[model samples]
Target: MSSLKHSHLYSYHAANSRLASFAGYDMPLWYKGISNEHMAVRTAAGLFDVSHMGRFSIKGRDANSFIDHMIPTNLVKVADGGAAYSVLCDDNAGIMDDILVYRFSSDDFIIVVNAANIDKDYGWFKQHLDGYQATMIDETQSIALLALQGPKAKAIIQSLTAEDVGNIKRFTHRRVALSGVDALISRTGYTGEDGFEIFVPDCHVSRPLQAEKVWSQILSDFATWGVLPCGLGARDTLRLEAGLCLYGQDIDGSTNPFEANLAWLVHMDKGDFVGRKALMELKDHETRKRIGISMEVGGIPRHGCEVLVKSEYVGRVTSGSFSPLLRKGIAMGYVAERYTGEGTAVEVSIRGKEWPATVKNPPFYDPKLYGWKRVA
Candidate 1:
């Protein structure tokens, strides 16, 4: 068997986590427990090692227009030091992968993409670079990324830096030194919480001990705040509770942004893009809509569970789980447009039994008490 790739912090994960293989990497499913890690992030803080995700730096004279041509989000609207969540699509408007575009300048940008699609996404961008005076560098192997998420995340990060992390604002980043290590710090995260993602170069020779030093230092200092190293299991449930989509499950080449409840990312008036024409034709004509579902007492909704209305087929669950914060079975799925309205009754077929459910808009928790909107 072929060996899986390891992150800079792999040794730490292996020492403390319940290990499993995901996306051809040996990953930690949970440390301590999924529920505890989930709750810690919701109430306190949780640090996640996300170096496996792909980070590509595309920079040169035509970087702006070069990137704007590929995705739906308006690159013009995103200023330097800002990030926009968007998707890469093919000519037919099928999503290649959901990504984050970080514009450092008109001719410089870094894109964070799904780990499993690193090679595919890199090729997608490189093929379009023939005419543009730009270059794309795959930096995934040379960097270590850490996400410190929670209401307490800012405070912990602030103590390590001389700069005011609170002033960084959401969706923006800046060059900062944390624990004496230089890195690009962004106020973004997958968990629906006020957090920061740190990207530092850990090239073994120059920054050999930096990533682990910052990680170990924080857990040591903030142990009383319940800050723990979280694994992928907690990450998944936290994202689902916050109503975020998982690439292969909630979306694929067959799913368009509109049907996936991501129409806001598309900018039709921003001139042309890769999938604009086809997306325009499919706009408002999509037969199904992505919806959130809350299950009854009987079962927990899971991926591929068929959704029904009046015992007839409608859609299928894309992602689901028993929420640790909400204490209920929550899910996100696609359903027929007619049956996608809030409060619409439906059934989720799990193990041959139809469990009662109600259609609702995400997230499955109250925004005022949880997520990035929670009191900070």
Candidate 2:
């Protein structure tokens, strides 16, 4: 068997989790079952060990200019301490990866990417560094990330730090001393909740010990507050309910921003970027579009299930799950552009049976009721 990399919190997960392999890492798939963990985050708060994601630190006099030239978003316009979601694409306009760019200053920034695309994304950045004077350093191994999410996330996190975490707005971040250890806290998450992603330095000589301390401290402090330690199983379900796209599934090298309903990330008016020219030319000619399908029948939709319109196959599901909050099957997939309108009727072929569905704007759960929109 191939050896798997372990995160700083591996020991904690091993003692209480059902371990599984994910992106070369030994990760926890679930602890108290997916449904229980899912509900915890929906109603209370949950902590996620997301250290498997890649973190890169970019610094140089030309960092801002270099980033603007690399991704499809206008990173230069993002204020300091703000983050922007963007797509990295090849010259042919195919998405390389969907990433979050955090701007600390004009010459300093951080790029967070999917774990599986780390090496490829780093190489892509280096290959385009001919004239740019930016320094890129992979910090994935040096950082341990924790995500505290859900309706009660703010209160749980606020109790641990004296940095006024409640004041941090979405897409913004700050560097503060968390539990006497320096950490980067960002108001961002994948679970569609009011949450914070904490970045703790874990590569020092003390190594995982420091990370474990922080993890244990959080659990001890928030256990009575209904904060459960979540695993990837719950994470997937929550993101699916929020209609968030997963890399390698909902999007891949064969898909572009326009086709994935992410055209908002592409800034054509901001000047030339890697795939700007090709994207601009083909933006209007896209035939398929990403849409949400909510099952109206009793069947559960799964990835690779056939999507049909008018009894004819149109596309396939990329991600799907039964939402714990909504108690219904929700899925996201690419379909013929004509069938992408909200309320359009469609069918999903599951287990050789056709189940009626509707094309609705995703977020099977209402944001105001469960997400960041609910303040306090």
- How much lDDT does each candidate structure score? 0.90, 0.88
Off by over 4 Å in 2: 202-206
- State how far residue 119 of model 1 sits from its true place (Å): 0.7
Per-residue accuracy of model 2 over 1-376 as CA lDDT, tens digit each:
7598887688889999999999888999999999989988888889999988899999999999999999989886689999988889998899889999999999999999998899999999989878988999998888888898888887866777787887789999998887777888899999988788988865532277766776788788878877789999999999998889899999998899999999889888898889888898888899999999999978889999999987799999999888887888999999999999999999999999999999989787776677777545
Clashing pairs in 2: none
Error of 2 at 192 (Å): 0.6
TM-score for model 1? 0.98
What is the lDDT for 63 in model 1?
A: 92
CA lDDT of 260 in candidate 1? Answer: 92
What is the per-residue lDDT of model 1 for residues 1-376, given as tens digits with 9 covering 90 to 100? 7498777788888898998888877888898999999999998899998888999999999999999998998887789999989999888898899999988999989999998999999999988888988999999878888899988999999999999887888999998889999888999999999999988865542344788888898899999999988999999999998889999999889999999999999999999888899999999999998899998777888999999998999999999899988788889999999998899999999989999999978878888898989865
